[model samples]
Each structure stands twice: as structure tokens, then as C-alpha cells.
Target: MVKVSFSSALAQKEVKKDAESLLPGEKDPEVGVPLRQPSRAWCWCMCLGLALMLSGVVVGGAYLYRYYIVEEGRVFVCGVKYREEDYIIREEEEVQLPSHFQLRKLEESIRILEREQVALINVPVPEFQDSDPADIVHDFHRRLTAYLDLSLNKCYVIPLNTSVVMLPTDLVQLLDNIRMGTYLPQSYLIHEEMVVTEQLQHVEQLGYFIHSLCQGKDTYRLQRRDRILGMQKREALNCHKIRHFESNVVVETLICEP
Candidate 1:
């Protein structure tokens, strides 16, 4: 009888334990420990990895931006010793020539056209070992153009009527492609011979661009032999030449003085 009573009490205790577990406040001991929340250090580590990846992406993007601008020639920066304003030309002149002096068309790749009474000449930067890459640019019909000397950090300007030309559409596209390293055109070499008919006495009257060019040198006004021969005969003159290159054209300007 005692054994039966003890068994009945043990079964009752088991039933009570199961009922306690079924209640919301109690957990069954057999279910094992509840899962723990992530540690603070682990969460921080994950955040750091994500932050590093984001920073890497930003840095890579910046590097690519700089590379394209430089390689594509969108931004041209000169040396620290150079100033931008010193090379600017504020003065310009326009001299009318007689219609009899006709400029011959050089070739298919080059054309000398007059737009709004301005003469478009195919002139380029004088070649020098120290000379940096430069570009010529102007707004069409602006009558003013600039020769940007990247090495010297100079922007020389001349009036269109004075044999300076604005950037043509074809040449502009070609230069862009060259800068981007996409295409290269065959370069043509040409020469222009000019005789110095008159020494420049009034340097002040000359444009700032030309004045800068003639600085420290005896400069003279140049004229073609064909034009001078038609007008009058002249003696042989002392001569010097400047070799220049731009885009696909190389020009040798021979300047002579009596």
C-alpha cells in the first residue's frame, strides 16, 4: 500500500511539472538554453567591414575621375611659376589687304576661309624641346582667338583679321580624339615664307600677344614675295625661320628682313 501511494505522488509531481512548462512564464527544462543575442564586438566588426568597402568604392571612383580628365585633355594645368593673367592679350588690330593678293588654298585638309572679314590661317605652336603641348581655341564668329601655351602657361590672343583662326569643327573633333588616345591622323608639313618689309617701330601699337612674341627681339612686318614683286623690286634679305606643329599640320614660317 505504501509503494502504491509513493508512485501516485511521483506521477502527480510529473503532471504538475508539465502543466508549469505549458504556462507562459515557464520553459521546459528539456528544450535547452535560449539563443543569445549577438555580441557588441561582433556587430561592430561587421559594420567596420561594410564601412571599409564603401570607402574603397569612393576612393576608386575619385581616381578614375582624375585619370579621365587628364588623359582626355579636359583639364590642362601649367607649372606653379606661371600665372594665367600675364599671357592674356587685351589689344587687337585689323588691317585690310587689297583683293588682288589672293591666298592660295593649301590642300584638301587645309582651307583658308574668311568669316566676317577675319582671315583664318593654319598656324601652329613653334616647335621647341621645352615647349609643352598646347591648343588653339575660339568661339566661332568671336573674331578673337587664343593660343594656349601649356608649357609657358600663356594664353596668347590675336584678332582673326590678323591671320589667327578659331578652332574648326573637324580639327576640334580630331584633337579631342587624339587627346583621348582614340585616333591619330597623318601629319602634313608646310612652309610659309615672308619678307620683312618694315621694322616694327611702334611696338605699343602692336597687340599684346605680338608684343610679347617680339619681346627682346628685333621684330619686323612681314610680306610675301609675290605681293612685293607685284608692287616693287627689293634686295635680298636676312632670314630666320620658326618651325611649329599643331594637330596634323607642321608649318615652317620663314621670316626675312632686309
Candidate 2:
């Protein structure tokens, strides 16, 4: 009304509005919105999780390397000293030590042996008639030789016949004897003995028979002639008790009590 300019009046209204907005009791433009800060708990948890994952990977890698990469490639050569106790009947003798080679090499040797028709047999004592022990042993050797010759074409057979006589008691004595140097060069003797002893126990059961002896019968007695006849029949019927086989030449020991 006092000749004031319109532009000046508009500017004054805008300033008044801005002042009102900044007043203490006025609503702020950003009211009711929460500000987010980085969480310390979440950061710590993520770091711990990553550390645990890294530790597990390291342990698993070590185990794999030890078992597969290192151990599987290693070769162990054992010196087998055959003691008299090693055989149930024969005296002590030393068998040649096996050539030391990696698992792959040994496997290759075995495959070669098979391809060349090698005869590898695990001999178990067959039940014999009422004859001398020496005769039984001799007969076994003869039969084995013939069987092996017939079975293989071009071959090298390792005779483990001495292993047939190994008894549980003999095994205990062997360990002690080897440790005490009853045999010379006690370096790897004990270790070899233990391996062989364990291996022998894994073979088939020993052969034996039960014979019943009866004294003077009074009334119900079968004559000696009849008894002898019956025995012959039984023997003839059970003659096929012995078991044998042939294949690519691998003998796995089966564990059982004697």
C-alpha cells in the first residue's frame, strides 16, 4: 500500500517460510528415517568363518598328500630269515629277500609273472594215511613238483613248503629268538619274523585225524577183519578231500584258528 515492489513482497514471503521450517518445534525433512552404521558383530562373524574354512582346507590337503602321494609310492624291502621253527618239521633255513620296489613296480612284476605262466601255489598239508611223517612230507613235495610242472609253461616257483610247519607257539619263540640274535645280523630280522609269522597264521588249518582205541570187548564186538574192511571203504569214499585249483597265480591268505 505504500508503493512497495511486488518482487520484494514475494522474496519476503519466501524468507518467512524458510524461517518457519527451521524453528525448534517444526518437523524435519528427514524425520522417521533411521541411519545405518557398519555392524561390528557381522564383521567379526564373517572373518571367523573365513579363517575356519581356510584351516579345514589345509588339514585335508595334508592328509591326502601323506596317504596317497608319499606312502603309496614308498617301497618296503623285508629280509625273510627262515628259522627251524618256521617249519613244523624241517629245520631253519633263510629264504631269499624279495626285491624292494614301489607298489607300481611290484604290480608290474606280478602281471609279468602271470603273463609268462608262472606257477604260484600256497601248499596246505593234505591228510595222509597212518604213515611216517617223513613219508608224508616227501610225498607232498613230489606231488607239488609234478602239479606245478604240469600247470605252468615257463615259470619260477618259490617253494614255501617250510611255511607248512609253522605253529602258533613257534611264532612266539621266533620273535624272542630273533630279538636275542639266535640268528646273526639282528638288524631287520625281528621285523621280518613278525611279518612272516602273521602271514603263516593266515593260511589254511593244519591236517590231523582223531583215532579211537578200544580195549577188550566182551559181547558186542565186530571182528578185526570186518573193522579193517569198513576202514578201507571209508578211505576210498573220502579220498577226494584234497582241494586244488589254478589261475593267474595270486594266493591270498585266509585267517582261521588251527
Best by TM-score: 1
> What is the Å distance of residue 148 in model 2 from its true position?
25
Candidate 1 residue lDDT tens string, 62-82? 878644432232221111111
Clashing residue pairs for model 2: 84-92, 88-165
Per-residue CA lDDT of model 2 for 1-258, tens digit only, reads 588556888899999999998888877778886889989999999999999999999999998875455323211121222221222222375644345521110011000111112222223332332111110111122222111111111111122333332322333344335444333231120111000011122111211100000111111111122223323422322111112222111112211111
Scored by lDDT, model 2 comes in at 0.28
What's the lDDT for all of these models?
Answer: 0.44, 0.28
Clashing pairs in 1: none
Q: What is the TM-score of each candidate against the true structure?
A: 0.35, 0.23
Model 1 TM-score, 2 decimals: 0.35
TM-score of 2: 0.23
